[model samples]
Target: MITHRLVRTWEVLPSGGYSTAWAELTGRRLAARGRAVGLLPEPHWVTYTLDTGDDYVTSRLRVSVDTAGGTRTVDLRNDAGRWTVDGAYRPDLDGALDCDLGLCPLTNTMPVLRHDLHRGTGGGGSGPHDFLMAWVSVPDLAVSANRQTYTPLAPDGQGVGGPRASRVRYSSGEFQSDIEFDERGLVLDYPELATALTR
Candidate 1:
């Protein structure tokens, strides 16, 4: 039962957004708890807990948010390849492979680093890997595993493995960013968002 801990500060980049999180990893399973306050353009307090296994191919996510509208809690999960939200199976999410909790990019580390992701290798971003993710939106408390894409980037000097460190761009709708991970597949930094490491 090997356990690892990590902490990261979340920001909105060049503005006044602040939050922090603590995460624990045991073997291939991960459990994380986090809180955010004063996230730019919106004033609210948000808290979340996320758990995953099999290299993040499956997950159970919970989140609560307090804002001018009110407070609400959301719970979601993906077992094997099946997805559920607030204890109900979602037929719309059939055949999804991952969960994107809209809260943090760290969750992206699980599949990008652990899966045998040769989807976009040497293709100049041609064959982008599409992850059918159980997506979550905190403030709205909406949950679904729509469609998201992860595209591998060229290698760079950083950690271990054949390419040392790796990069991947996560895209959904109009959202996208290049995320870097260490050799162990943990996120080193998420552009304009957060940086993380084992403690």
Candidate 2:
């Protein structure tokens, strides 16, 4: 990943308060400025991929919020506009934690992120394609090729948290996202990599 490294700063919201962040990504960084306002620390950053041919466009934001309960980051990914939480998940898998879950519903309108030819073109996958490239704690169930269930982050024994990473490679796209787990399969916090700082 020799791509330019981006840096951003954010403020925590007062429970239901508001927050915002900004970044300049340029030379080695690619000349980008990103800004966002939201209730949660919700990810806000400038993401530019030479592979996507968006050098001129400002990168979209994926923010991490620091709140009363804990710190969290909602990372948006791929050219399809998918989203993921990069922090202490509530352990409540009400909706499939899979980013593909959201991308599927928007397939008809999901913008095709332009990429290098080596990345391969979309073959019109039956579903929104596999956005499950993010790491999963569960492996017992087979990869359905489509967003089906809440891929457990810990299916081996008991998932709590640990130093582990789960990644789901897309079948037809250049997408990659992962979750670092504590020994218990629970998600951990990378204070250094956090998009926002708590007030």
- The most accurate candidate by TM-score is 1
lDDT of 1 by residue, 1-199 (tens): 8887877665534224555667777887777787776654567787888887766555777889888878989888777767788888898998876666555655676667555342235433435777677777656779865787877876655532235556777787997877766555556567766644331
* Clashes (candidate 1): 2
Stretches off by above 4 angstroms in model 1 are 13-16, 116-127, 156-165, 192-199
Per model, state how many residue pairs clash.
2, 25
State TM-scores per candidate: 0.77, 0.21
**Global CA lDDT of candidate 1, please?**
0.67
TM-score of 2: 0.21
| Native-referenced Cα lDDT, model 2 | 0.25
lDDT of all predictions, in order shown? 0.67, 0.25
